[model samples]
Target: MTRKLLHTALVLSLFLPGCRLENLSADQLDLITNSVSSTFKAARPISDEEEYYVGRAVAAKILTSYRLVNNRKLTDYVNLVGQAVAIHSEKPFTFGGYHFAILDSGEINAFACPGGIIFITRGMLDAVSNEDELAAVLAHEVGHINHRDGIGAISQARWTEALTTIGSQAAKTYGSKDVAKLVGLFEGSIDDVFKTLVVNGYGRSQEHAADLASLNYLAATGYDPHALKTFLDRLVARSGGSQGGIMKTHPATRDRVDNVAANMPEQKSDAAHFSERSRRFASILGK
Candidate 1:
């Protein structure tokens, strides 16, 4: 009986990779796949050097289509806020001292590349009426950077020699059509430049982890933990049955807000940290 079971298990392992049985239960297969995938990343601090290179090699293509805001003061302001939050992150990352930029757009969006490069859109910045919401948003992006989600996303997408140049960075050219095509596919909506920056939204669990991390970052910086939930709530409201493909990549805003709220640390009056309706972060895009 034991010998027969061993043979069966080996055969199943061999058959599973390309298994295509339309009548098979989707639920059972998903559970099995997720469980198997978990083992490869069962622990924290996903470390793969190749993932970093692939992401770094693709960074320029992602940013090329974005319209940038050249406001020096506003740019500095966002960096200052982002830097403060990044230091407190579990990854505590400082990729070449991480560069941050503000992109000019009205659609809410932000993305972090390998090597600590992060971009925030004018739309998201305009939507945030105060410091707390901005901080919450930035922290969540940092969580992805620190966790190497960029690397994880790329691992699934093979980096062909056609994309990479003779060597690495120095030889690479991002203007290639193939790279942009890949980006279009990943982002899922080629409607606008912002649409091309589709970040691989983590699973529901990863988003929750980002929320918890953002809450901590906010709390450490003397901001209210509830601010995270507040910002996410605003996201849900603004999306209003249409997130324009951006929200489609991220987890449910409502469920995420609830999770962040549950994990918040109790505190006294949040008046000092609360900055709602303050109209702090502004944009040239706003009419």
Candidate 2:
């Protein structure tokens, strides 16, 4: 009996010795990967959670260096628009707070950051001719926030230094050097990556994703879907076909407009009415 028991124990021990425990379950890996992708987490392309965190940390620092336009009314008004559109976003506003700010910039631009921080340049606000136009711009930026564009950009880890270097000959793109460094975790290092993101601009695919998302949001909100196309048309015309720095990296505004027009849904439902406050937008910006 003792010999038989020893044999059984020995067999069990041998099998157990070869077995190894797994820290991440299949579900866990899928969750992390898909969730990050869905949110467009910036560190994703790097394929390291730590790298995403580090790059994002650098992104945060870069955001602070710019001069933000301070107006409680403007902030509140923009937030109202953001929240309304956000409720219908793919990811929704469950992750974190959605913030809106006005930057004292002359360029017609708006941007969304990871976790829902959004900014519209004073210049972009100046470009709006009506409530729908303004909503179109805000909705477009909100679309980026909702679809996680900023995070996605940070997640993609390709070295864009050559393009960035070419872009840095200008002054506006120069300030974003610190943000570009975070890409170094990939093939390069932080110093080089940060320089790249600021100068070269996000690739065409990202712009397409953002444009699609914006159209979806605009349709969802009952805003004229064509407003985005109109704005881009104006921008192209205004730029005299140059495509400028921002448009240069983004999908051709004309192409995107056509694409959006073709796919827009016919929705007659009221998009949660908003106080356009046209005069307020101009007055708050001191236009």
Q: Compose the digit string of candidate 2's lDDT tens values, residues 128-151.
A: 765566777777666655554554
The regions of model 2 sitting more than 4 angstroms off are 1-59, 154-198, 243-245, 249-252, 268-287
Instruction: Please give, for residues 1-287, the per-residue lDDT of candidate 1 as tens digits.
Output: 45434433333344344434343365534433333233223223434453354445555666676777888988888898899888887766554556678877776778777657788888878777677778888888887777666555543432332123212322222234433444444342122222223744567777788778888887887766676777778778878787563486564578777887788877553663343324344332232
Q: What local lDDT does model 2 show for residue 233?
A: 72
Task: Name the TM-score of candidate 1.
Answer: 0.64
Clashing pairs in 1: 105-123
Clashes of each: 1, 13
Once model 1 is optimally superposed onto the true structure by TM-score, how far is the C-alpha of residue 130 displaced, in angstroms? 0.4
